[model samples]
Target: MIDRRDALAGIVAMFGATLFAPIARAASVQVAVIDTGPPSSAVFTAGQRALVSALSERVIPTTDTPGAIAAEVPQFIEKLLADWARPEDKEPILAGLGAIETRSRRDYKVAAADATPEQQDALLTLAMNDQLPGGADFFDKFRQLVITGYYTSEIGITQEREYLPVPGKYDGAYPYARVTKVFSS
Candidate 1:
């Protein structure tokens, strides 16, 4: 008869092997092309889509790895807003995008997407600090969504962060200095 503890450990070990297997990468990954038709019932307009892309990229810019744009986070956000979010849940995001544009045009005479990187960063900083009226709430939600989308994407999981397959025995005294990229969990 298998003891409960022994059975549980066996099950965990079995699943862990399957779950932590290394991913296979293709030389050219094919991405689905979304329809670029008129926005009759779409959650985001063309301009709003552009704004979301720009804002999300700013949140996770290309450093040593691919950024939010490369990870398709904007498309993820659009799908979430269209399929999952309630009307009330989307109002703040739309309002925030408008506010960002307003601030950008007022300060730099250009839209957020057209503004320089420095200008975009400054605007993001202002929004983050709650200096932009009616924008703080939007920033909080948008930033969370961007991060969630990025971290869940393949580029984020495998490229930006280190992926450890089948973690070894626990070492409580693991040296922080030896740690390079953050481990994807």
Candidate 2:
């Protein structure tokens, strides 16, 4: 007879195997995860999309790992805003994006996307430092979304770290000394 505790443990052990599982192709995996695709009614304009894309790329630049843009962070964010964010939450974010552009234009004579990467970096840092009005709130939230979206994406989970499909049993005694980089889910 399977007791509740035993059943729960079995479920957890089974689910845990997926954490180290090899991912499929990037596009296929992305399609599987976001079958609905980026919001059909994406809120941002072409220019706004460009701004967020550039900003997301800056937030998680291409390292050995692919950056936020490669992880499709901006699209995920647009979907979240379209489907989940309330007016109060969404409005401030949009306003902040516009503000960044305004500041960029004023300081650099270009939009945020048009500004050089270094200038974008400086502007983002300045905004985070409370130099821009209400920037702290916007930057913090936007940064978190970009981060979460990136890590949750398939490319981040597979190529960024080791992937082994059907990772077999979860070893309670797996040695930490054997780890080079922390495995991604």
Please name the candidate that would achieve the greatest lDDT relative to the true structure: 1
Tens digits of per-residue lDDT for model 1, 32-123: 56644433267787887888998899999988898999999998888777755555778888888888889999999987888888898888
| C-alpha RMSD of each candidate structure in angstroms | 11.5, 10.4
Residue pairs with clashing backbones, model 1: none
The lDDT values for all models are 0.83, 0.81
**Model 1, residue 40: what's the lDDT?**
28
lDDT of 1 at 138: 84
Worst 10 residues of 2 by lDDT: 12-21
| lDDT score at residue 147, model 1, on the 0-100 scale | 95
Candidate 2 local lDDT, 73-149, one digit each (tens): 89888988887555455776787788898899999999898999999998888778868877888799889889888
